[model samples]
Target: MNTNKELEYCNVAVWFDRSTLHAMMQALVEAGLNVAWKESQKQFRVTVYTQHGTSDLTLLRLNGAYKLDELDYCVRDMRLALVLYQFIEQAKGHAIVKMMNQDKIVVKNIRYGEAVRIVEIKGAEKKVIYEKACSVTMDQVIAALKRRDAEERIPVMRLELDYELATLYDAIQAKDTAQVKKSKDRLKQLRQEMLLLEA
Candidate 1:
C-alpha cells in the first residue's frame, strides 16, 4: 500500500485483497470518483479527484490502512482513487476513514505567536479511506463478516470515524450492534457531507 496528499488531495497505490483495497475502489465508484489509466490490474492506484471541500472531505473518510507514501501530484488522481478503493475493503475491521497520526512533529521556522506551530493533526485519514471504500458502517461490517465463509476470516469491520472508531472496533469485532447508533452518530457529520456531494 502507498498514500500521500498534495494540494488538498491524496493518492494511494494498492494490491488485490491487501486490506481495505476493495472498499477504496467501491467508494470512488460510489462517490462518482474515477481511476487512473496508467495503472494495470496488478498494481492499481486511486486518488481524491475534486477540489470541492465537501467532495474532498467525503473522499477523506476512508477506513483503509497501510499508506505507501504521501503522493507528490506527479501521478494522476484517477489511478490513485481506484487503488485506495480496493485497500479500504480489504482492511475490514481494521479499516476506517480517519486516524490520529500521533507521530507528527511540525516545526515553525518563523516567529512564535506570528507563526502557528503545526502539530498533532490526525494523519491516518479514515474519512478519505472510507469515502474511497464507498462504505458505510453497516455495509463494511456485513462484508467483513461475510468473508468468514469464503475462508477463515474473522467477522469484524472497524469504523472510519474519529472518536467512535476507537470505541466501535470492539463492537464490530464482537459483532455487537448495541452501539450501532453511537457509531452512526459519530459519523453523522461526514455521512451527511458525503451524501450532499452526491446530491
Candidate 2:
C-alpha cells in the first residue's frame, strides 16, 4: 500500500432476495438506472453494485419468520432515511434489526418480511445509535486531504513530520529499542522521502 495515497470509497455491494432483487432491478431499469454490476443465486439471494448512490435491496428477508438466524442482514441500508423509509413501505411489517452501523445506512437484520413500496424512513426511525454504524475512516479522510494537497503540502504535516523525526532521534539516543525498531526506522525514511518531495 502506498502510505501517502488514499481512496474515496470501496466497491459497496447491496444484497437482497432473488425476487426482490429482480423487482428492484426491473424498477430501476424502467426508471432508467444503469446498473454497474450484479449477480444472483436462488439458493441464496442477489447482490448488486450500482452506478447510482445506493440501491434498494428490501425483499431479501422474510422477518423473524424465516428459518435463518439474524435475518436483518437481508436489508442493507435500513438506517438510511430514504432506504429505511422505502424498506418499511416495501417490507410492510415492522422490520426487525439485529444491528445497525454508524451511518445508519447499512444494517444487519437477521430476519426479513413481506414486500411493498417503502413509505417513510422512520415509520421506523430511532435515535442514539452506535458510532460504529457509519463514520468517516481516518485513512479515507486523509486520502481526500492529500488528494487536495497534491505533492506540495501544508504547514501542519510539516510540523508533525518534524516532531516525529525529533522524537525518532531522541529514541535512538535513549536506546528505546522498541520505539527504535517500530517507528524510528520506517518513519525516518518515509519522512525524508516526503521532505524531498516537498522541496
Candidate 3:
C-alpha cells in the first residue's frame, strides 16, 4: 500500500462489501462520470474516465481483511476522492443534504439487534430536530435510543395531562371554580413542556 505523509495522522478505515462497491459505482455514474469496473471473487479493479485522465483504483481482500490506500489517492487526485468519500459515508448510514435556503439536513440511521434508530437534523447549526426508534419492519423515521430520555418525558407529561383533565372534569361536575382554574393552568403547563421536548 502507498503511504501519504499528509494523511499519516488521520486513521481512515472503511470496510467494503460487494453491494457497497456497486452502489458507489452507481453514485459516480449519477454524478455524470464514466466508470468501469472488473470484479473477481476477492478483488475489484475500478477505473474512472475523466476529462483530465483515467484514474485507477484497486481493492484487494487480504485474509478476510480488505485494504486500500484511499488517502494516497485523495492526495493525488480530488475528483474521485470526493465521490469515494460520499459513497463510504452513505454506506456507513450517514448522509447530509443541502437545502435551497443554505440550510442543511443530516440523517443518520443505526441498527442495534432488531431495532433501528434514525436521527434527523435541520438547519446550518445542525440542531437535533427529530429522533425516534422503531423496529426494522416499522420504518418511517427514527433516532437513537441513547438520547431518547428527553422524548420519553413527553408521553409521561401527556399522561399527567390526562389525569389532570379527569380532575378538572370532576371539578366541573361539583362546579368548583378554584379547582377548575388550577387544573386548566396545570394542563397548559404540561402542553408547553411537551412542545419544548419536540423543539
Candidate 4:
C-alpha cells in the first residue's frame, strides 16, 4: 500500500494513492461506504452498499481488469457506482466523474508534467471544463473551489426541500387550507432555486 492523500467536502472524503485491486476495496470502506468481500473457490464476491441501495459483484482477482457498467449493476441507483469510480483514480492512472447535473471532476494518479484536459458532457453537448494543471492554474483552483462549495450547499438545499415537504404533508392532513397554500408556494420557490443550482 502507498501513502494516501485526502480530499474532502463535508461528509465526503476521497483518497488518492497508487491502488491495487484489493486496495480499492479498502478505500471504499475507509470512505465510510459499506463493503464486504470474500473468496470462495478462487472467485471473489463483493457487495457494496449505499444510501440508495446495494450492488453485488463477482471478480476474478484484485487486478484492474473489470469495468463497472451502470446498466449491468443498479439501473436506478448511481451512488454506489460513483463511489467506486473515485477509487479508479489510482487503478487506471486517471478517472473522470460526471456529477449529476454538475460538472465533471477528473482525478489522475500520475502527473504528466503538463496540463491535463478535462471535459464536460451532457446529452449531445460537450465542452472543455478545464485544461491547465490544477497546481499551476488559478482557473483550475477556482473551479475546484466552486465544486467544493456546491458539495456543501447541495445537501443543505435538499434538507430544506425535505422539511418543506414534510410540513406540507402535515398541513394537508390537518385540513389547513391556508397553510397548505403557503407551503406549496414555498416549495415551488425552493424547487426553482434548486433547479437553478443544478443547471
Please tell me which predicted candidate would have the highest lDDT against the true structure: 3
Tens digits of per-residue lDDT for model 1 on 37-98?
22343333444554332122222212233333333223224344334433433431111122
Worst 10 residues of 3 by lDDT: 1-10
- For candidate 4, write residues 70-151 as lDDT tens digits: 2223212344444555454333222233333333333322221112455555666777766653323455445445664553
* Candidate 1, position 72, lDDT: 21
Report the lDDT tens digits of candidate 2 across residue range 58-122. Answer: 22233211111122333232223234334333532234333333333333221113221121122
TM-score of 2: 0.23
Report the backbone clash tally of model 3.
Answer: 3
| lDDT winner between candidates 1 and 3 | 3
In candidate 1, which residue ranges exceed 4 Å CA deviation?
1-19, 36-42, 46-71, 74-199
Candidate order by decreasing lDDT: 3, 4, 2, 1
Error of 3 at 35 (Å): 1.1
Worst 10 residues of 1 by lDDT: 107-116
TM-score to native of every candidate shown: 0.23, 0.23, 0.36, 0.36
Clashes of each: 72, 27, 3, 0
The lDDT, on a scale of 0 to 1, for candidate 3 is: 0.52
Colliding residue pairs in candidate 4: none
